[model samples]
Target: MSSLLRIVRFTRSLAPLYTAIIIASVLTSVAALAVPFLIGHATDTVAGALAGETPTGTAVRAVVLIAAAVLLAEIANTVISNVGGWFGDVMSNRMRTILSVRYYDKLLHLPQRWFDSEITGTIVARLNRSITEVTNFMKMMSNSFASMLITTLAVLTISAWYAWPLTVLLLIVFPVYVWLTSLTSVKWQKLEAQKNEQVDIASGRFAEVVGQIRVVKSFVRERGELEDFSRRFRSTDATTRAQSSHWHRMDVIRRAFLNLVFFAIYVIIFVRTVQGAFTLGEMVLLIQLMTMAKAPVESMSWVIDSAQRAIAGSRDYFRVMETPVDPRTAAMMAARPEGSRDGEADGAAGSAAALVRSVPGAPVVAFRGVDFAYEDGEDVLRGIDFELARGEKIALVSESGGGKSTIVNLLLGLYEPSAGSIEVAGHPSAEVPLDQLRSRIGVVFQDASLFSGTIAENIAYGRPEASEQEIVEAARRANADAFIRRFAGGYEQVIGERGLKLSGGQRQRIAVARAMLKDAPVLVLDEATSALDTKAEIQVQKGLDELMAGRTSLIIAHRLSTIAEVDRIITLRDGVIDEIGSPAQLAASGGIYAQLLDLQSSGDTRRLARYDITA
Candidate 1:
């Protein structure tokens, strides 16, 4: 998108202030023009009065009135600027809001692997980066450029009226200043763009190190991390210095050029005075007005420079905007009937795959020949198929990089398949609004994203309307109630950003409690116990057990011991399902499942047998 159009669209959200702001800009410009006119009129009127050889009341009155008028215009300009400033702020805020909304919507549409594992840190950098470009444009439009443009025109007009030859001479000289400014600004803007990229990478690196500070300390890798940071920091520093030098160079050239122009004009004006036409006052006022006009033009260069950077920054923003979201099977579909599709087949098979929708109980989750790949074209999940009967629990087991987590992501609609499909309840996963689909499934990942907030708030995140009793019940079910109650403030205690203040097990328990509070028919636990202690693991397992009852559950466990109790253990290898059966059955079959079990046996086979005691 064109930068101007992007800026306009960005400002569209500030409809309330937009009209008032535009008018204020025009008025500010006109008022600045009036300054020279006021000064010129006042100077000429006094000159004429003195020429008449009398201290006339009319001259005195005119001078006072003109002075008063100039004062009034100055006052009005300042007031209008403040009002315009408020509107500028409104526009800047709305632009940021629009950017944020677009960013979040893109996040929803984006395939998971495109971000690799650095998604969270990238997300943090995005949020942390300054919106200086947008804000600068708004401020310049209202406070700087609008009025300055008017003042420039006004000064030139008056200068020509007083002395056309000088005005024309200065006008010829002006474009050189403008051309030089433009050249340097483009170079500076490119440097700024590079600096912006460095800042993002640096900021992302900072967040990454901070997130893994514990590991850094444990491994004594602080020096390594700091050195890595120093490399990026030096790059940022070089770009910043380059940008600063460009502007400084432009300033020095403009100042020297202005001095040369002013000297030429003064020498010419002095000759005119010696030849006996130009007065002392005219030359004095001419110099002052000419200098005043140059000031805005000088500042105008930086304004243009910032405007260029804003345009460049938006390339990243617009690149995100250009990508397409997943296509839906249908624009709309009614809820699927209650009871199994096997009983009646849901929604007449809305395509090859349809989501089940029932009035009561939980949503059924299913994947049909779902194939997916990353942006790099490396396929992660091959054409695989399965159905999670309503309220049935399924645990996913696989060696590392077996696309186990990819399955959970597909079920959650984070990624649509390269071929095949995913269905929720009875509607195609792509067919249902993703937010609505996600609303029906509560997910808890190994590193559960916990925002800085209270335990109660985080637990009830998806279900903001959940009652206090419901929240407490969820905490109790997640095996978090005991530890939570022991805390001084119970549920009111803050979790801190990403639950950094809490233990890994504590965060995991809180995540489980959050999913439980959601009360969705579909629940996901991706390595839910990976971060827990033996005691905490057992406690969390009890909570998971209670939470999974009568819910369609999908679990991804790194340790084989974790999934031994699930209703069905589906083993994945190289993106395809190798086996699907109860743990004991899989072990007896003596395939990948038995091999995995031997690696991480916790002697909990009876406990594993609880969720799926194969009849």
Candidate 2:
């Protein structure tokens, strides 16, 4: 009931249209009611003529007038009902639009951590199912409920005037039928929820499998995947069958009681007419009114079923909406600039770019005694301290799972530190608005992470309003222009999903061009060349060198040779800083960095495996 009320409240903005529909529905009910009365009057007039209790001419005229009145009433009912349906259709679609847009907007604002545990397909499935059921139920109610209520009330009142006993019996059946239906609601909803879970899991896995089809094919797991998907759906099928059986068994019992009560009603009306308590026409009118009342009572099961589904759907929808958004992410969204790029403020002077220029001598990035952990997990980094001055370049050298990427994630505000603080551009990182902080930094990941779009679109993603010439210039500096222009569509070529249509080198270079277009003061190359062949790495590294020029750069690399040009190298062991020095100094210091360099230099594959380091 609360969910139903919430849905009602959510659509309060469309009240005027709803009010119009209700008014039309009432008028339609009134017109329909007139038909039975007119037909009954005509029957009496004909009977009077046959009994010779009135002139035949008088009876004929009265019958003709009654017939015309019935025709007019039927026409009015049809027209008014259609108008109400039109209003309902408009309101329902508007409700759907409002719901879908808000859901999508909420998704955009949810934090990364909230998304980490969710499946992409499950989230999409929930949105689709919830919105579809809610809107469809609303449309059904808007079109039918008003008319049903008015018809039921008019029938009951008229029947009571004719015979109070019959009215009492009809009223008794309603509560009994409703009580029986309510008995199944809890159990039915439980099964429905179970079914929904299985379906969501199946859908999530289906999307995952399709998205990583190459991996599945290489693994030869197609049969296993199909069996798993079928198993989930079969579970849903079993739950659905049980739910359906329970509901129908209850329905059959309810209908039997209804049949007995209706039988009693008909018998009473007939006996009363025979005893001269009602005229032939009055009997007909009473019987028709009973039928009208019975229609709504019989439909109660369908109404309740739809309502339950809608309630369940609405509950799911609200669950997502009610989840707490990260306070920092909320602030970031609230502070987003209108009609400007994502991290830019209102104008050039107040933008993050300007902030970078204002703090020329301060450390561009700093981490002081920072501690970090995943949710409910041991710390990945502890008491880490680091700083990068403007135009300085540093590289993080560490074995796999040694917290290099985690540091980059924390620096970008994807996650907060468990303790201590980080500072950017002379201000505590927590004090800096996310948009302003992120606008000052650019990052290139090893995977490239390009979407399915034209090459130009991907390049200009950071700054969508960048001109063609600016995009081309960024591409040229990233060493991607020559190969891009050779393609049939040049920069306009469509890159398949994640840029799979391009070679590894081409994709990496395009990612480099994208970062170049962002033109941030601080650059982060997170193993940008680690996934490429030697030739590809050489080509991509040239672009990386160009991107890092005159910028405060933080590079993470597994291969020790890549850091030879960096001003300093910070090495990690067991989630804490183990060494910090220039490459030559670290080499001579015989620390973790020096040991890894020696292992690589000696080509000792066995020794490298212990550190999870790969060449």
Give me the runs in candidate 1 sitting further than 4 Å from their true place: 1-5, 15-22, 25-52, 56-70, 89-109, 117-130, 240-257, 273-285, 327-363, 557-566, 594-615
Question: Which residue pairs collide in model 1, if any?
Answer: 341-345, 354-426, 355-425, 355-426, 355-427, 356-425, 356-426, 564-608
Which candidate has the top score in lDDT?
Answer: 2
Per-residue CA lDDT of candidate 1, range 410-479, in tens? 8876777889988777777776865577778888888878889788999999889989999999888888
* Predicted candidate 2 versus true structure: per-residue lDDT over 389-499, tens digit per residue: 888889887667889999999999888899989989888887776677788899999889999999999999999999999999999999999999999999999989989
Q: After superposition, how far is residue 520 of candidate 1 from its true place, in Å?
A: 1.6
TM-score per candidate: 0.82, 0.91
Our tally of clashes for model 2 stands at: 0
> Candidate 1 vs. truth: CA RMSD?
7.5
Model 2 ranges off by over 4 Å: 53-68, 332-361, 605-615
lDDT (0 to 1) per candidate: 0.72, 0.86
